[model samples]
Target: MAARTVSFGIGFRVGGSLSLLALLAACSEPLDLDMRGLMNGGFNTADAARASTAPRPAADNRGVISYPNYQVAVARRGDTLAALAARVGLPADELARYNGVQSGDTLRAGEIIALPRRVSEPSPATGATTTGPIRPSSQIDITTLANDAIERSAPTPAAQRPTPQVGTEPIRHQVERGETAFTISRLYNVSVRSLSEWNSLDSNFSVREGQYLLIPVVTQAPAPREVAPIEPGRGSPTPQPPSASQPLPTETPAAAAATTQAATAAAAAAPPVANVGTQTAASASNAAMAFPVQGSIIREYSKGRNDGIDIAASVGTTVKAAASGQVAAITRNTDGINILVIRHPDNLLTVYTHVDNITVAKGDAVSRGQSIAKVADFEPARVHFEVRKGFDSVDPMTYLR
Candidate 1:
């Protein structure tokens, strides 16, 4: 029997092979699926680098995001604790201890690290170049957005916002007529470089009238260390008491008795001597400053949280000076709340905030318990009062009567 030879077309075979390959590819897992560090839990450096490139939560201009109770910093790719600390103007060891990490340890990009305390906020002087911090309370209101054309545009990505320095929420300053950046920085006790960086100022630092600027955050400088008081008899040399080197003639029994009786009688008749040290201490106690407001304290002093005490009072209640002093500064916060700073003797300062209807002006001499301002009509109608020694905040209760 003769067999018929069947020829297979080259194109058909090639097409069939291609179809098979396509089917296999469709059924197989995606090439983009990453199963890295799955088998041995040992990730290669290349894999780590790639993973770090993933998007991290956005930080403010200063790479900080502050919550009501705490603040955190978002790490950039290839960041280490030491590098981050230097960038934020914090001690590397301190930052490491706060996050339970070593200063040299590399951090995953976008990892959130807690801060020990606040560092400075976005300052061009410090050379920080990230967008400003995220503060929900500080966000522009809906009404303002509806009215302003610029704010109505699509929200800017966090990376593109003005850079922030590590600190508290920034003060939003509306440019006033004839106001310059230098004057504004002086007003807030910050550097002009900081102001320019925070608001993204022009090369000339020129500000237009009616423009809005973010005032750089400022933290009080650390108080100078105090020298402890010397212990009694330890400060200086004292004359030694009479020694037994010289002996006195012995007295007869009757004479000794008479002399003792006379001494006793004289001692009994003499008036008591007041201790100078005791009197000075008592005077200081009596001189404690009076409370700013007569009301229950709604909030107590908490370092890094509440620097002062909040006293609940009726609106228009007189807020008195905590101590006798000259009004050093009469300013307003970004929230439009009045802040009065008084400079007392011995480097003491008293602060009164959330006030309205200020009756006193800067450089005015005020006596303790004299009215300086009135409590504003805030929701709680409270006055926030603080006592500061130098630049450091101290517990008001320590000085309050």
Candidate 2:
């Protein structure tokens, strides 16, 4: 066969046209490619340089789709707070609070709305009322009984009763507008159970204006002694005596030396009271935490599978705070499961998820074993408990005694 050659870009050639693919393969060397440049829409040298130096958006591993800021969500057409909350499995109130909008407020389409990373599951309806915690007879409908009691106890003539002294005896309180039994109980520093028992009223009974009810006189409990707030993983510093700029009195050299020697001896003999107290406090804080809900652990903590331990429990089981701490957040997962996060000392955080009802609000201070919520079924009727040190998840079993 006669030799034939073809010339193409830069030194490319093919001889004798064995096959177009084979000829090209023989002449072409493997070329190094700038994949990044090609992926950036084949940016030119200048554009590539600019892109390399441009600031990149921050990234997180939360596994949720977020906007550039990661804290705000862009509203789409016909997006209401409630609808959006439902779509994201958050409570409407939390979503509204994040956006600084009222729950009933209308939202403009294409508006930029701030969103909380998570939602809070709405507390469950208690008994026949949604106003307060579930009572013993909450499920019982005593409307007829309350009506009968009202009929039986008609208002007494003013002349027949002596006026009560302001602070001496139980006084008659006139029902105000927009007041419920729960609110009345709180105002009087009494319990709803006590109020219902005293007045023979049912949980569902409505209070009307101009109605007189006997307010029970309760002796207020003594206030708790204030303690320094404990931060996570840190101890309270011992207070030192104040120092004066100018020296006041001078003592004899011998007396001063004697005093110094005595102080040193005392300090050396005495145990480290402050450090002991701190360690004791830390130990107590750790010991105070109990399982939020008692159940068999169905799911163990795994790095990628689950962040917390799942305990299988029945619905309406009381969920207590694992430790003494201020409520950091009460949010919900994307599955519409309620989550309660409490910030405790030692940089520790306890999370209770799949809750049925919440009794404490955000920022409320709760003690260990305090009934803060109730557990309900999420996937298999379980409560999810997570112990975290700052942002890192830790095995709860390690710290949980």
Q: Pick the candidate with the highest lDDT.
A: 1
Give the local distance difference test score of model 2.
0.53
Predicted candidate 1 versus true structure: per-residue lDDT over 1-401, tens digit per residue: 12322234666778899996896687422221233433485432222112211112235554665544555676677899898888777899988876666899986665556677876553344344543333333222211221132222224422233422333455556678767766565466555555655554556777766554555554443234488988899968899888799887576689789999999999999997653211111114475788777766778887555767888878998888878888777666457766677888897778787888899977789997788888899998888887877556798878864
Which portions of model 2 miss their true places by more than 4 Å?
1-288
**How many pairs of residues collide in each model?**
15, 5
RMSD of each: 25.2, 29.0
**Each candidate's TM vs. the true structure?**
0.40, 0.30
What's the true lDDT of residue 387 in model 2? 83
* Candidate no. 2 TM-score: 0.30
Q: At residue 131, what lDDT does model 1 achieve?
A: 32
- Model 2 pairs in collision: 119-332, 232-346, 232-347, 233-346, 233-347
